[model samples]
Target chain A: MFLIKHEVQVLDAKLDKLHHDIMTHQENILILTAEWSYLNQPGRIESLARRHSDYRPTETKQIINIENLPYPKKTSLVRGRIDGD
Target chain B: MVIKFDGLKSQKSIQLDGSVNKAIEGGRNRLLVLSCVFCLAFVAAGVRLLDVSVLRGLQEPIDVVEPTKENLKIGRAEILDRNGILLATSLSVSSLYADPQEVMDINSTVEDLSTVLVNLEKEKLFKKLNQKKRFVWIKRGITPMQQAQINALGLPGLHFQKEDRRFYPQRNLSAHVVGFSGVDAAGLAGVEKQFDGRLRDGSEPMTLSIDIRIQHILREEIKKQIINFNAIGGAGVFIDVDTGEILGMVSLPDFDPNVLNSASADTKFNRATLGVYEMGSTFKIFNTALALEAGTATMESGYDATRPIRIARFTINDFHPQKRWLSVPEIFQYSSNIGSAKMALDFGPKAQKKFMKKLGFLDRLPVELPEKGKPMYPAPWKKISTITISYGHGIAISPLHLVSGVASVINGGIRWPVTILKKNSQSKMFGEQILSLQTSKDIRKMLRLVVENGTGKNAAAAGYMVGGKTGTADKQSPTGSYAKSSRLSSFVGAFPIHKPKYAVLVMVDEPKGNKKSFGYATGGWVAAPAVRQIIKRSAPLLGLLPVDEVSPQIRRLLEIKTPQQKRGNQLASF
Candidate 1:
């Protein structure tokens, strides 16, 4: 009975340590998420993109409706090309 | 004597034996009772252990864990823009505090802390540390590097408390909308104050309808115009007409929410929703829409603009006067005050007052911002008051009211209560319809005409089908007279007139005209071009495709006949 009580106490201590570890990790995750949000502000990203990349914000004239798109043209196929290898 | 002694001894021996037997029996009975008691206690304890481990294990563990002080410190939820970009958030910062009583070597402590927290004055630290009080805040919202350096000091009484500091990542870009929280993490202004309880619960992020990109565009455009026109201040608002969700609301001379306490009251004022003004000719949209909805006027109905009408010492005239009988469309296109007054008189005071009340002009605008303006208008409905109010003089209201009212006029006659929060897709879309479908259609045509052929030509964006009205009202001077040179030039516009989606209002306060604008500080000269630029830039971001202006459907809807034909039709009707 004494041995069993001692073992149970040991297990409880282990569980407590695990719980504390989980809490600490959760706090770390929260901090990381906040840092990520700060780094990903739109104005910062836009300025960075302007300096380092070819990408720019989309202009109104670049956008068009689907109805304005041209139809695809038909092309003739050669049947023997498949067995060329 | 020896025999008596022996007999006594025998008696004594017998008594001792009997006593021993009795003692043994009593011991046996006591042991049995004690054993039974031990067995029952063991059984009870075993049952309790089993109940706790197995029976109660099947159910949730009701562990009443006490919340620590750190856990009790409420963290505010983040505020995100429509695209999930962070506008406002709460970051956990270690605030430096001191238990002055526990502080040893006060001089050294103050010296050490002041070195790490450079912003804190040494003299102030010395005075604070010398205080008889138990606690004092040495500094708050310290950087992580400073916290680490202070921790390295390992000084007694000097401790760091984990605190949540509200952060506005976009800064002044969304100052008025995101608002600022107090030092205690309690919301104090704007959306922060409006949804304080929800934010305090630290639930999921609150997503607003504001798009950061659109907000940036509007602010940049307004700033440029404010500078170019030499205006003292300006405000602009962009709203989704269908959803009634505000996309971008910019009030310039805006302050950064991050440093809100030091910002001036004027800088913190939200002009878009709070500042009330006599919105001038923009109110004509309401007058015209009301007349059409009442069936008292038609598109071809003519109003006499042959001369300014004198009514109760006030001469109602037009800015660009047409000295002839102008048709209903002509009246709207020209923005003739005389014609609008006549239309209002024909509509009658009773109906006009009812319509104005329905449009939400008689009270403060129901918006999320705490700073709101109560509309000022004449108490009694007099004849001259009707005439002046028709031209947007006697009645004063916020730009938000005008935009939302105009949105109702063009958006299938439904008046959706304006909101800053994003609407969920599953929610209902239709608001109360205030006009018939035919009347709404006619109003849209008249607005389109104003942009295509009349005063709001500068507000037109090519391929966007922009339609709107211009309003230039003179500011009421402190001496209770209209200031001639000081004007509030505003342009209220919407795009894709056939299927309106967004409504924008741009108002430049006290704009002075330069030589390039021909010294005319009118709405067209000062505010309209800014609206055009805003539409042109923000259209693509909103996924709005610019349509061909000359398309058959669009052309047919926006087509207006010549003045001669309009007159001939009017003559025929007579």
Candidate 2:
């Protein structure tokens, strides 16, 4: 009985430590999520993209419908058969 | 001694021995009872301790004792755009407070705090620290750096309290929609105020119907126009015609929701839904649609537009006057106020009032914003009122009302209420059928005509099949007369006319005439081009495929017949 009581005491202490660790981790996660959102604001990203890279937003008129695309050339492919086959 | 004892002595000795025996027996009984009671108490205590530690432990552990109430106060749920982009959120921050009664050396504490919190006044902090009160706030929303610095100071009586501070991640991008909160984290305006109770009670993020990308595009275009025209202000709204979900609503001179306290009344004003104006010829869409719905007029019905009609104190005329007999379609295409009034007179006032009411022009728009404008119309229906209102002069309504009503007319007659919250695509649409399906088709045709060849030509986007009307109304002065120089130029339009999907409205307040636009600050020159730019920039982002405008179906729907065709047909008949 004495041994069992000692073991219980040790387990209770470990459980308490785990709970505290979990709470601390949760608080950290909350703070980080807020920081993530702040960093990912659309305006911030757009300005960054403009400054750092050559990429720009695609204009609607620039996008062509599939039907508007020219048909693939049969001669561009090996005339007799499919390449893989 | 026994041998010599008399009878009385022998009796006394025996009695004394018996009494001693009785005393010993009583003492023994009391000791036995005491031991049993002690043993029972020990057993009971052992059982209780075992039950608590072992038996109860067999059950699942209690959920992590949620952080204390202060740490768990997720102030209000975060607000996200339709694409789950964060617009408004609450960050848990540490607020610095002082227990004034426990504070020692108030001057030194104040100096240390003020040094760390540069925005705080040292005198005020000193005063707060010296108060007899138990607790006083030093700063409510301190940065983490400030919190750490204050902690390093380790000043007695100073403490940190965890609090939730509302943060707008997108800043002024969607300010008027995801409004700011007060010091106590209570919503004060916009969607924050609209869904205050739900936001406070739940921790899940509230998703709005706004798309951040579209919102940025619309605001950028509107801002550009406002600067180009040197206009006082501008507003724009884009609504999904089928579902009535407001994709983006932009009001210029918008303020950052994070710093709402310093925003002026003009900056906070939501012009799209809250600023009512005489919406000029846009009302003609309603007049023409109503005229068709009532069976009093057809596309070919002609009205005399030879001259302006003089009634009482008003002369009803058109900005682009066509002095001839104009067909119903011609009347709308030319925006002839004289012909529209004659049509309205033929349709009668009661029907017009009922149609306006059905279009939600006689009451406040039921959008989620706390700032909604009540429509202004003449109380008693008069003859001249009908004439002026036919061309959108006497009756005043918000831009939101015009867009929502136009959405109903073009979106197959269903009048869906405008919503700012993201709606489930699978959810059933909610609206009443206010116009016949046939009449709606006819109206769509007429609107397409305007965009194809008439006033709204500037608003046309290639392959988008933009159909809309242009409205240029004189701003009503404080003295109740129309100001000549101040024009409220606006354009309301829908795209992919055969199957309308989106309705957009752009209104510019007091735009100045510029040299590029031939010194004409009309809706066609100002607001129409803004709408065209918005649609062009937003369509690809919205994943709308550009259709073939030359296809027979689209061509037949949007084609405008020339007057030469009419003359040729007449000659052929002869």
Candidate 3:
């Protein structure tokens, strides 16, 4: 009984440490995503591109349509359009 | 008895000694076990406490995580000209907060903070320190320098929160159309208010009908004239003739959204979209078009413009006072009020109202601007109103409404709602037909004649085939009567009359005439020249090709017989 209880306590400590490590990793990932979006905004990208590149970037006016997209090979898992009537 | 005592004593002594040693051994063993258990428990408790209080923050943890706040912004979407220039944007700034619990050296801290934060009261900051709150806001949107100084004080508990603030970078440049964002980022006026939903929440930037470069030209030239003539206010607009887009719009006395609280009401008012004025002879284009479209008049049509026509309580007279019969083209070139009134009489009020309604002049304009005015029209639809409105005196409409209407007149007679969002050219073009293509062509001819030989002669740019109308309406006093002296001068013109591409409108209110203008504050004298300057500067930037001044096609399309009165005279000089 003593040995079992000792093992359970050890497991609990290990679980707690894992939780902290996972939480810290998640926080870092979220911060990175926010930074990525900020840097990717067109105004900032255009400024950087103009500074470094000889060619001016062209403005895009296309709106992606679902029907025009390619179908996935795993057809069995695919369902009806996510955005549709 | 002595033998019995010796025997008992010996046995007792041996038994007692043996038992005492055995009991001591057992007691020691139990004490050893208990000591080991207690030590283990103490170490476990200490480790758990450390993990909770220091590592895992299960106890006494600092609440460093920022709470997710609700977005409380209500302001309109910003309008940007085509080039991604910041016609409008939101700025994020640091707002100061206080943590009373952390504050030490309160009096000194307050004194130091006051030196950096100019608007803050030292006494108030000191009073805040006396409060029991864990946190309180010291000020919203403190300058970075102020924040740095506050930080230098090392006052333990001072904190800051970031706030998003709306700003118009191109301040007052396209004031009327771009509008201004409100304190909470809600669209209170112009495009900001009009497309608030798209601007407030959408991921993409909103593109407006404005061209920043053209907008700058219009504003600079208009400002020059306003300063030169000492005008009360000036407004200008540019439109794409083909797309029905407003390229540039400006209203002087514009406010900077950055210092909104300090700006006066006059600065906030948008004259181009909100303030409706009697556009005077600018409306003659509509009248002439309506007459030709309804078959009530033709290019060969003549009106007796020899004398001023007396009506019930009004007498219609031309500013130049031509005392002879006028052809349709001559009437427009000369801007004959009598002739316009006669043409309106033939067309009748019902037709005029219908045509104006179809031209989108009756209701509030369908532009992506929130501050547009609902046009003021007479309820009774009286004949006098018709005659006066024909010459642009009785009805009042916003300059934006006029721009859209004129675009329809020239853009193959189609009315497309002006927009601020950049659009894909391939998107199916949608517009309502407002006039016959033939009528639109004929109006173009007459408009070209005005610039070539009419009141709009001053509006001509050397190579750009400019066609426009000049208007000088008598300003009405607050007492509901027209003032004899004050005038509201305006000019609306389009370029490359054979194939119109852009329209420009400039209006100046209460202009004090100067010597260069010969003490004249009429539209031709004040506003037309501003239009000319804007075109001269914006033409190259727009990439419009400079044409031969006397292009054969332009000359043939804009032919006008020199009137009999001026036939022998040197080409009537401006």
Candidate 4:
């Protein structure tokens, strides 16, 4: 039983390390997303697109706040339940 | 006989049975054909199973779980000054949390943690462990050293959640303009609150008009003077003459945004932008500007400054009383209250109000800062109020308000919004033509005279054409009376009058008379020298060339009329 308990402890350590690695990867994704948005700023993107890509810049108005933002079509489906229920 | 016959019949019957058996055999052959067909079908089914399982093994396997970990919310954008200085930013900090299921000895871990983090509550830590939660926070935003020490304890279930803490790198250097953030990282005051949404967009750094270098110089000068004088408080502002940009603004008794909890209300008070006082003789510049703009006075126009004018139980007299005739230039040079009152009388009440309104003194200042205070003008607009305001006593306005108006007076009469940020080339110039170009020129000529011959002689920085006005007023006590002993002394001046670049102002509140001031803490003695020191230090930084004393620009700007020089009479160098 003592040996079994020791094995369980090692397994737990491995599980914890795995969880930490996953979280670290998740954080890296967030940082990449932030950097992507930073690069995609209207001015920066336009300059880049003009130099290296076929995409064109479009005029955008400042959305004053989050509450006043327009809703997306697929947003309601996020909870995994359908409207029929 | 019947048996024998039966035997004979039996043979025939046996023959018949054989024929029946043959027929039965034929049926059996048909059944055997059906059995063969059934075996063929079973063989085909086995071949189909082999084809599906073995031959199709190269095809991709169907997935059991879907991958959906791409979308997450982003944090707010950073705010930086024009030169890429970090005015506001976020730092990643680790917060301690725990999972009770993995904990070996909760009591020992809690005890060790509480010792490291002295502020941690013992009961709370014990309760969190006993509550049977999988995870709970022990502390938020512990320093890295604390985290390392806690980790060294090898406590089970101890974990950390990485968080972003907003940091102001410049600290209280420009607190009033940069403002501060709340615990949730929301802007609570100043520019942070005004541009809150823009900051959250995360597109680019929000650049402000403030220059950290200029801000440092202005704050240092104000702090030095405030300390030296041992006064209650003071404020200083440096404004661009042509563009109306506020290069620097400093209010004494400012607090660091990082240590905001220990700050008092007075420390948080933004005196330069929010505190409005009856700016004494600084308004004389405006009064003279109005007189010149209204064509009410010429440089040579004479006003009697010999006696005090008693109007309705209030006497208007110059602090340095000159019981003699004075010209318009002389009136301004000596900062004579009687002569200024006469000039205001010449402009009259209607014209004076109209001119001040044109300067944007009657409303809130137009700077980008949100901590602006409205001017306290008289409600009834009486003649006495106009006359008293002429010498700067009745109407109260902020130091920023005075700086903007003074910049207009020197920058050929264009009152633009004072800016902290450097203006990009695309921004169009904004202001109104309050004074004619000729009137601006004439005022500049006279302001230079104040530095040369008048009470502002102490405000001279050698080789720089410095011109300004001195103002001293009694501070009103709480019981509806003016305190005789307390005074607010202020000086406002600009350099190289021919081509003005900056306007600097220094104001001291309730300064006591020290031995150095010879029992007199008036603007001329106390505030003028502060302005002189500021110019001596700030001029070279602004890249202003201190021309030769005999340079035509200096000669024309600072020429004051004087009687033939006596043998002992020596001219001041600034």
Candidate 5:
């Protein structure tokens, strides 16, 4: 009986620790998500890229052909052999 | 016997009478009664003690029925653009406060708090701690690291109050649309107020039809025009013509909703939805559509516009008069005021009212924004009103109304009400039919011709088949006179015109001409180029391919016929 009560108390303590960890993790996720979105705002990214690199806005010519979309027209391979081949 | 004898001896010595012995006996009986009462009380106490101590059973634990509260927050749900970019989000933050009475050592407590919250001044903390009040706010919106440090200090009096604060990740990029919330997480304006109940439920995030990429392009173009032309203000909106889903809407002098308290009333005004103007020649689009739908005019019909008409102290004259007869298509292409007025008079006022009513010009715009303008039209509906209204005067409608009206006319005559929520492209569309399919096709041709050869050439954008109309109205003075110096110049159009998919509008208020424009502030010079720039940049992003104008299918689709009869023949070139 004593052993059973001790086991129950230990399990209760473990459950409380797990619940506390979950709550802490959820709060952390919320804060991190808000920060992630703030950092990923388009204007900030665009300005940073412009300052660091020579990038221009996309034009019609830059977009690939619609027919070849979802997969490019060609994939090349060197004429080398694998053991199975 | 010995006690009684002693009492008797004491009584005999004091009184020497039988009465003394009787008195002694009475006293003894009284003492005995008091002792019996005391003994009964003691016996009752002893029995209760034994009953409680020996008969009571083992103790049992009370059950806790309350569910965990960490997942249950009363915060507003997130708002995202159509592509899932977070526009507005609710974040849980910690607010530090102190109980002055609970502080064991005020100096030490203040010192400990200042270590974690570096920005807090020591003097202010001392003043707050010295106050007789029970509670005071130390700081609000503390970061997690600061919270952890404060917790590590294990201060007795300090506490953290958990609160939810709204954060606009996009900042001012989509301010006028996704509005701000107050400190208590109550929505205040725009879409926030429009869907307050759903947002307050906070079950899931809501998505708006606004595409941030297109919104950025549209705002940038309008901003550029406002700066380059030195305009007082500008407004622009672009929509999916078929679905009536607003892809992007921008009203310049917009506010940063994040810092909403700093935004003034002028900057917060959503001009695109609320500001109404007498939309000069653009109303001619409707007049032409009305004439064709009512059988009052045809493709080959001719109107004699050799001279301006003068009636009721008003002269109806074209801006660039040809002073000769023009075909139905010519009146539309040249945007002749005399020709449009004549065409309007043929159908009369009653028919025009019915037509306008069907096109939603008679009511407030049915958009989701609370800021809306009711159109101003002449209540009496006179012949003069009809004539002026035909050429886009004597009636004031919002820019949103004109854009959606153009959309309905171009989208095979289906009048879909403008919406800010995304309409599933695969869902079957049901809308009111305001015009015949034939009239719609004919108007599409006229719009394309305007871009190709007429006043809207600047609107040829990401596609060759862009179709549009331009409007330049003299702003009315307070004393009911036209002010020539101030004009409302605007351009509205659709791209991929043959199978029209998108409609856009750019309006510039009181733009002063610059060296680049050669001192002209008309729509052709001011607002049309902005439309072209916007559509050209945004079209590739929107997945609209550049149409090949010379292709046989394209040529056949946009080909216009010249009236063969001598009466309808074109004027000879110089």
Candidate 6:
């Protein structure tokens, strides 16, 4: 009886600590998500890309379906290794 | 037992008398009674102790439910985009308040707060702290860094209360959709107001259907056109035609929800869903579709456009009049007001009224926002009302009404209720089929032809098959007369029009003519190009695969043939 009561006491204390940790982690995650959204605002990123990088808005003409890519030419077949097939 | 009684000392000691015997008996009985009472109390106490420990333990279980989130009452809930980008969130921040009566050395405390906080009115603070009152707020929302500095000061009477401060990290990006909340963390506007109970009670974050990236693109494109044309203001919305999800919606002259008080009423007004306006010739899309669906008109049906129709001191003229007989497809292609009005007459007012009501045009927009506008139309269904409403006059509806209504027409004629929340992928959606499949297909072809060879040619984005209608309405002045000098130019379109996935609508209020547009402040000149830019840039991000424009399959879906074309009549190939 003494042993069981002592074990419950220890487990209750540990459960409380875990709860506190979970709360702290949730707060931290929220703060981090807020910062990420703030930094990645569309207008700010667009201006930054324009000034420091080669990225441009994708044009409609640039987009194509995956199936539209031509299949590999028959003449361009590689010289065979035993396992290359 | 050494029993000796006081009766032995009595006068009856001379001989053993009956009195002595009686006194002895009485004393013995009293001693026995006292002993019995003491024993009963001890026995009762023992039983009670046993019952509390052993019996109760078997009957009831110990409660060990671990309370996690309930321990801390810090914030309400968060709002995120469909992609899980946070749009609105609340953080637990310390609000500084002071008990004026407890404030020791007010001058020093004021000096300490003034330095730590920017834009702090020192005089106001000093006056407030000098009062005999118990509590007063120094500042409601303060940064954690400033809070740390105040804590370092270690001033007496200055206390902090933990409260959640609502933050719009996206700023003005989704102002009208996500809306704003009050200082008490209660929602006041937009999605915040719509789902206030869920946001307040539940801990899980709410996800909106709005894609924030597409929202930014739509806003930027609309703002550019509003500035370029020097228009008063504008609103735009894009709906997923298949799913009835609003992908991106923008209203210019929009306010940043962060600074609610500074924005004017005009800027705070959400023009997209809350402001109803005459949508001009865009209603012809409905007129033509209804005519086909009612079997009053066919694809090769003809209407005379030789001259303007005059009725009851009102003359309906086409903007680009052909002055010749036009087929049903040609009437839509040219946006003929006379022909559309004529078609509406043939169909009559009863079907038109029912169709409009079925399309949700007779009621307030059934959106989640509190700022929704009620559509305006003539209460008494008259012939003139039907005629004018055919060309989108004598009626007013919000831009969202047009977008969603057009969506139903194009997406196989089903009227799905629009929603702002991101739907779970597995949820089945069902809506009433309002028009026939053949009518929907025919309307799609006419819409494509408008962009291909008619007034909406400017709306064509490369590789993505575009289909649309252009609208230019005369702005009504305060005196209830049309102002010819001012115009409302708008364009509404769907992309990969053969099988549309999205519908984009843009409307510019009172745009002025510019040199590039050949001094024409029309829908083609002002609004169509903006829709073009939005559809082009956002298509790739939306996972739309562009197809070959001249492919045989694509041409077959959008091709139109008229009676004049079949007969090779002497007419312009429009």
Per-candidate count of clashing residue pairs (backbone under 3 Å) = 0, 0, 10, 5, 0, 0
Q: TM-score (0 to 1) of chain B, per candidate?
A: 0.87, 0.89, 0.83, 0.82, 0.80, 0.88
Q: Estimate the overall C-alpha local distance difference test score of candidate 2.
A: 0.85
What's the best-to-worst order under lDDT?
6, 1, 2, 5, 3, 4
Candidate 4 — which residues are off by over 4 angstroms?
A1-85, B1-74, B97-110, B118-139, B154-159, B557-574
**For residues B1-574, could you state the per-residue lDDT of candidate 4 as single tens digits?**
3457668888767977889789889999999999999999999997887776667746854642332332222355666665656677655668898888888887888888887888888888888887777988778777789989888887888999877766666777768887877766788777777777777665466777666666776777667666767788988888888888777788888888766789889988889989999888878888988887787887667789999999997888877676887777767766789999998998799998888898888999877667889899987888898889998988889998898899998888887877766688998887887888877877787777677666678888876678787788887677857786887888898887767788888888887777777767777777788888778766766666566656665676545444421311232211
Q: Rank candidates by TM-score, best first.
A: 2, 6, 1, 5, 3, 4
Taking the tens digit of each residue's C-alpha lDDT, what string does model 5 give over B285-394?
A: 99999999999999779799999999989998988788988888888878889999999999999999999998899899889877788899998999999999998999
TM-score of every model? 0.86, 0.88, 0.74, 0.73, 0.79, 0.87
**DockQ per candidate, 2 decimals:** 0.39, 0.50, 0.02, 0.01, 0.37, 0.61
lDDT of 5 at B485: 90
| CAPRI category for model 4 | incorrect
Off by over 4 Å in 3: A1-85, B1-79, B99-107, B119-136, B561-574
Instruction: Report the lDDT tens digits of candidate 3 across residue range B225-267.
Output: 8898899898888988777777788888777665767888997
Q: Stretches of candidate 5 above 4 Å error? A: A1-8, A61-85, B1-74, B96-160, B425-429, B462-464, B563-574
TM-score of 6: 0.87
TM-score of chain A for the candidates in order shown: 0.74, 0.81, 0.57, 0.53, 0.69, 0.67
Model 5 global lDDT (CA atoms, 0 to 1): 0.84
**Candidate that would win on DockQ:** 6
Q: Which candidate is the best by lDDT?
A: 6
* Cα lDDT tens digits for candidate 6, B1-574: 3435875465446543677677878888887887788788878887886887687868755676656565653577889998998999988778999999888898888887788997899999988987878999999988889999999999989899988888888989999999899999899989999989999987788988999989998999989999999999999998898888898988988998988979888888899999999999889999999999999999988999999999998898988778999899988888999999999999999999999999999898777788899999998989999999999998999999999999999999998888788889786787879998888999999998888778888898987888999999998899989998788899999988999899999999999988878788899878999988988988889888788888998888877777565432222221
How far residue B314's Cα lies from its native spot in candidate 6, in Å, is 2.4
Question: How far does residue B538 in candidate 6 sit from its true spot (Å)?
Answer: 1.6
How many Å off is the CA of B501 in candidate 6?
A: 1.3
Root-mean-square deviation of every model = 5.4, 5.4, 13.9, 19.0, 8.3, 5.2
